[model samples]
Target: MRVAILGVGLIGGSVGLAARQRLGAFVTGHDPDPEAMRVGLDVGALDAAGTLAEAVADADVAVVGAPVGRIPEVVEAVLRHAGPDTIVTDVGSAKGAIVAAVDDRRFVGGHPLAGAETAGVRHAREDLFAGAPWYLTPRSGSSGVVFERLTRFLAGLGARPQAIEAATHDRLMASISHVPHVIANVLVAQAAVVLADDGTLPATGPSFRDATRVAGANTTMWTDIYLANRDALVDRLDDVVHRLQTVRADLVAGDAAAIAGWNDAARADREALLAVGLAGGTAPSCELRVAVPNRPGVVADVALALGHAGINIHDMTLSPSDDERTGEVALWVDADGASRAAELVAGLGLRVEGAP
Candidate 1:
């Protein structure tokens, strides 16, 4: 399978790397930045493509990993260049607008819930999507075959695929991802004002740091994201403001019981939500133990070997033997990919010690 990546930044590069390294796909990448394209090739993300048109031409799948603002345009271009059977998907955070714009059976809206504060192809890693939630929003008239194919492909990348409607995905993301980023910015702004005089924030705890971690995100990217999902984000922001108003009123009235009740309820709900997330993310996987010499780059060699064979390692741990001469590496892969994983690992002359 040949895969074309529109933008060779972090997410795009990671997708290319995983497709080539873990899915055995011929990956091609195109980016406006020549440096990014060079870095992508150097890191083994993909082969070079002269242009977007060339990248998508004859490709089985084209992933539009451009910024949120440019996604629709890029998707359109991909569609123009892509084969009729080529399945096109986007990694944009805001999906409603893109999904509505692309009226094609082969187009699927996807958002991989995995990233770091850092950006660019230089920072891309093949494991970025491992065990992460990848939301897919299929268009109204999307083909079932395309949807299933995309879902299975995402699973092969070790991402947990969840299907959701575009509108619902936007609203949920507004609450979970977008709004939190806004709140973080707000909190840090307020802190900056308070600390202006002394230029210090003493006695700040982990909670404060955690809350303000995403205070200043990528301005260009976030500006587009905020504007694209303005309506849903505004609705969620209003809800947050209303909740804050309620808390203020309770505090003014000295309603200790009310405050305590609200806190308890919120704590329980948060716990329940986390529990559900844990269970949903833990897919059935197979574990294989392999004996290896305790040496530098041994693990890397094993990983690269599997990568060359298109087998993804979901997780791994190493334990040394009594003499410290050899260690057992416990590797995990999705149950469906286990047989291939074991076969690939065993071909490296290591003793595979588990049924998986």
Candidate 2:
């Protein structure tokens, strides 16, 4: 299989890495930035491609990993160069516009619910989408064969592919992803107003830090996302405002019972939603821990090695010692593949700490 990745940044590079290292696909990358293209090659994510046309000329699949604002244009260009049977998809966060713009049978709108706070190719990891939800938004005219093929390919990359409509997907993302980002920025802005003069921001607790972590995100990328999905975001923001106003009224009236009830209901609802999301389409997995030196790219190396061996890691957590010289990585894999995964890690000169 041949895969062409456009805009070889974090998501694009990760797709290339996974396609090559896991699926044994011939990956080619096209990026406007030369440095990003170089990083993709250095990380074994993709081979060299002189231009976008060259990258997708004979490709079986072309993944448009450009930012939300540029996705429509890039997808159009990809469709122009892609083979008639080639499946074209995008990893843009906002999907409605892209889906509307591309009226091709082989085009499938997709958004991988996996990323890091950091951007750029330097931070790309092949395991970024492992056990993550990769949403597919196929229109009525979309080819069923293309959808099935893409789903199977995503599953091979360890991603859980879920089918959803474009409008519903946009609204859900607005509520879950975009609104939280806006709230984070607002919370941090309010905090700055209070702390600017006193310089006592250092006293903020972990709760505050965690809540505001997404504030001041990649400005260029987020600006594009906000504008593209402005309508849905505004609707969700209004709902949040209404809820806040209701809470304020309760507080002003000293209605303690109402406030308590609201909090309890919210907690219950959140727990239920989490349970449902976790339980759906979940497979049994075995957890294995491996002790290794605490160093850069150790996790990436372990993940790539496992991918090369066709062992998909469902999830992973790294626990570093206080001295930072050693750490243990707890990796979860399919129950059937656990034994082989252990052997693969052990072969890497890392100690397998416990039974799988």
What would you estimate as the lDDT of candidate 2?
Answer: 0.83
Q: RMSD for all candidates, in order, please.
A: 13.2, 14.3
- List model 2 lDDT by residue over 149-189, tens digit each: 77778877779766666787789899999999999999999
How many clashing residue pairs, candidate 2?
Answer: 0
- Candidate 1: which stretches are off by over 4 Å? 197-200, 283-356
Compared with the true structure, all predictions reach lDDT values of 0.83, 0.83
TM-scores of the models, in the order given: 0.79, 0.79
lDDT of 1: 0.83
Error of 2 at 106 (Å): 1.4
Candidate 1 has which clashing residue pairs, if any?
Answer: none
Taking the tens digit of each residue's C-alpha lDDT, what string does model 1 give over 309-354?
4354555667778998888888776676678767777787888867
